[model samples]
Target: MQELKAALERQALAEGFAKMRVTRPDAIPEAMGRLRAFLAEGQHGQMDWMAERAHWRGDPAALWPEARAVVMLAETYTPEADPRAATLLHDRGAISVYAQGKDYHDLVKRRLKRLGRWLIEEARGRGSAAEIKVFVDTAPVMEKPLAQAAGLGWQGKHTNLLARDLGNWFFLGAIFTTLELPPDAPETSHCGRCTACLDACPTQAFPAPYQLDARRCISYLTIEHRGPVAPELRGLLGNRIYGCDDCLAACPWNKFAATARDIGYAARQGSPPLAELAALDDTAFRARFAGSPIKRIGRDRMVRNVLYAIGNSDDPTLAPAARARLADPDPAVAEAARWALARLGIAIVDNPDMPEP
Candidate 1:
C-alpha cells in the first residue's frame, strides 16, 4: 500500500498537480451537518442546486458507495501579479485570476482523465481491478473539506482551502476509486488569531470566522446572481467585473505560494479597459472571451456587471459606454445602464429618468 501510494503521488506530480493526498470516503462526516446548517440559513444565495443535491454533496460516499478512497489534488493558478492591484484600477474591469485564461474546469479534467487511466493500468499490472471517477469544480462533491481530509490544507477563516505551503490559489480535482489507498493525516487549521481575510472583505461576506454568506459575496453577485444586482452591493463591488478576490489575496500564507506552473492561468492582455468591455455586443463579447470561463456568463449578464463597475468607477468618461446600453433589449442590462448613468450624473435627453424600482 505504501509503495502504491508513493507511485500515485509521483504520477500526480508528473501530471502537473501541485499536491496529491488520499483520504477515506467517509473522512468528512461533519461536512454534511455544516452544509445543512448553511443551507437552512439561506446562505447559498441563487445557487439552489446546492439544496437540490444536498445528499450527494454532503456525503461523497453517498455519491459513489463503491469508492473506497478519494484522491484530492491541487493545481495552482496563482496570479503573476497581485490580484488586489486590479481592484485599484477603477477604470478597468478586474477579472478574477481563475477566469483570466482558458477554463480550468477543462484543463484540470483532462489531467484527471489522464491520471485515472494511468491508475487503472497500474492496478491491472498488480492484478487488482481499479474503477475510478474524476471530478473538477462542477460536481456536487464537497471539494474543500475533502481536500482538508486528504491532508492538503485546512479550510481557512475565509472558507477557502489554504495550506502552510500552497496558500489558497489552487483549483481542486478529485479522483474517487474502488482501490483502498492509505489515507493521509487530516490537516488542522493553521489560522490562529488572524482576521485578515474577514477584514479584507469589501462586502463583509463573512458573518463569522470560518463561515461565508454567499449572498453578500461579491464573487457570487458578479458571477452567479442573474439580472440586475442589488443596488446596495453594486458600489461595494468596485471594478471587479467577473469575480472578487479580496479574501484570497489578503491571506498571509500566500507569501509561500508557488508560481502557477500552467501558463494557461496567466492574466490576458492585462485588465481590459472597463469602457472597452462595456462596449462589447453579444458577438464581440463571445469572441473576446472565447475559451475563457468568463464566456459562460454571456453578454447580458457580463454587461450588467460591467455597468455596475462603471457606476462605481467615479470616472464620468465611461458614461458614454453606459448610455449606449441604456436601450439594451435585456431589461437587466438597461436597468444597470440607467443606474450607471444616474451614478455618473449623466442625464440622457431622449430617455426618461426612471427611479430604481
Candidate 2:
C-alpha cells in the first residue's frame, strides 16, 4: 500500500498537480459542526446549494460510503503579473486572476480523470482491485477541509486553504477510492496572528478572523448575487467587474507560491475596458467568454457588474458607457446604469423640468 501511495504521488506530480496527499474518508469529523455553524448563521447568502447538500458536504464518508481513502490534489494557477494592478486602471474592468484564463473546472477535472484511470489500472496490475471517482469544485464536497485532512494544506484565517510551501494560489481536486491507503497526518493552522487577508478586503467582508459573510463579499455580490446590489455597497465594488482576489493575493505565504505549470492558466482575459464590456449583448457575451468561467454569469449580470464598476471608476468619460445601458431590457442593468450615471455626476431626467435622479 505504501509503495502504491508513493507511485501515485509521482504520477500526480507528473500530471501537473503540485501536491497530493491521502486520508481516510472519515478524517474530517469536525468539519460537520463548522459547516453547520456557517450555514446556521446565514453566512452563505444566496448560495442555497450549500444548504441543500449540507448533509453530504459536511460528511464526506456519507457522500460515498464505500470510498476508503480520499486523495486530495493541488494545481498551481499563480499569475505571472500582479493580479491587483488592474484595479488601478479606472476605465478597465478588474478580472480575478483565477478567471483570467480557461475555466479551471474543465482543466482540473480532465487531469483528475486521467489520474484516476491510471490509479485503477496500476492497482489491478499490482494484484489489487480499486474503484475511483473524481471531483472538482462543482461537487458538494467540502474540498478545503478534505484537503486539510489529507495533510495537503491548512485553511487560513480567510477560510481558504494555504500551505507552508504551496501558498494560497492553487485549485483543489479530489479522487475518492475503495483502496485503503495509509493516511497522512492532518495539517494544523499556521495562520497564527496574521491579519493581512482580513485587512485587504475592500468591503470588510470578514466579520472576524476565519469568519466570512458572503453578503458583503465583493466576489459574491459581483458573481452570485442577482439583480442590483445595495446602493451603499456599489461604490465599494471599485473597478472589479468579475470576481475579487484581494484576500488570496494578500496572503504573505504567497511569496513561496509555485509558478503555474499549465500553459492553459496563462492570462488571456487581460483587463478589458469597462466601455467594451458594457456594450456586450447576450450573443457577444457568450462568444467572448466561450471557454471561460465568466460565461456562466451571463450578459445581464455581467453588464450589471460592468455598470457598477463604471460607477466606481471616478472617470467622467465612462458616463456614456453607463448612459448607453439606461434602457437595457434587464432591469438590473438599467438600474445599475442610472446608479453609474449618478455617480459620474451626470444628470438623468426624462423631462427638462423634472429634477435629476
Candidate 3:
C-alpha cells in the first residue's frame, strides 16, 4: 500500500496536478456543519441546487458508501496578468481568472480520470478490489473542504481553499478511492487577523471573515442570476462582466505562487472593450465566446452584464452603443440598455435606431 501511494503521487504530478494528498473520508465534519449553516441562512440566494441535494453533499461517506480514502488534487491555472489590475482599468471589462480560457470543469476532469485509471490499475495489480470515483466542482462533493482535509491547502477567510505554494489561484478536484491509502495530516488555517479578502470586495459580499453572502456577490449576480440585476448593484459592478476576483487577488499568499504554464487558460478575445461588447448580437456573441465558459451564460445574460458595465462608464461616447441595444430581444438586456443610456445622459426613444446620441 505504501508503494502504491508513492506511485500515485508521481503519476499525479506528471499529469500536471500541482499538489496531491490522501485522507480518510471522515475528516470533513466541521465543513459539513458550516455548509449546512450557510444553506439555512439563505446565503446561496437563487442557487437552490446547493440545498436540493443536501443529503449527498453534507457527507462524503453518504456520497459513496464504499469509499474509504479521498485523493484530493489541485491544478494551478493562475492568470498571466493580475486579475485586479484590469478592474482598475475601468475601460476594459474584468473577467475572472478562472474563466480566462477553457472551462476548468472540462480541463480538470479529463486529467483526474486519467489519474483514477492508474489508481484502479495499481490496486488491481495488488489483488485488491478497489473502486474509484472522480469529481470536479460539478459534483455533490464539497471540493474546497475536501482539499483542506487532504492536506493540500487550508480554507482561507474568504471560504476558498488556499495553499502556501499554490496560493488561492488554483482550481480544486477530488477522487474517492476504496484502496484505503494512509491519510495525511490536515492543513491548519493560516488566515490570522487578515481581513484583506473581506475588505477588498467592491460589493461587500463577505458577511464576515469566513462567511460569504453569495446573493451580494458580483460573480453570482453576473453569472448565476437569471433576471434583471438589482438596480443598486448595477453601478457597483463596474466593468466586471462575468465574475469578480477581488477576494482572491487581495490575498498576500499569492506572492509565492507561480504563473500557470497551461496556455489553454490564457485570456481570450471576449474579454474586450465594454463599448465593443455592447455591440454584439446573439450570433456574434455566440461565435466570439465559442469553447469559452462565458458562452454558457448565453447572449442575453452576457449583454445584460455588458450593459451594467456600460452604465458605469463615464465616457459619453459609449452612449451610442448603449442606445443601439435598447431594442434587444431579451427584456433584461433592453431594460439594462435603457438604464445605461440614462447614465450617459442620452434620451431613449422606443426605437433603438433613433439616430446616434
Per-candidate Cα lDDT values, in order, are: 0.92, 0.93, 0.85
- What's the distance in Å from true for residue 188, model 2? 1.0
Residue-level lDDT of model 3, residues 9-60, one tens digit each, is 9999999888899887788887678878999999998988989888788789
Against the true structure, candidate 2 reaches a TM-score of 0.97
Model 2 regions more than 4 Å off: 351-357
Query: Which parts of model 3 have CA positions greater than 4 angstroms off?
Result: 350-357
- TM-score for all models, in order of appearance: 0.97, 0.97, 0.95
lDDT minimum window of 10 residues, candidate 2: 348-357
Highest-lDDT candidate: 2
Better of 1 and 3 by TM-score: 1
TM-score, cand. 1: 0.97
| RMSD of model 1 against the true structure | 1.6
lDDT of 2 by residue, 1-357 (tens): 999999999999999999999988899899899889989999998999999999999999999999999999999999987788898999999999999999999999999999999999999999999999999998899999999988999989888999999889999999999999999999999999999999999999999998889999999998999988999899998999999999999999999999999999999999999999999999999999999999999999999999999988889999998888887888899889888988889998663332232
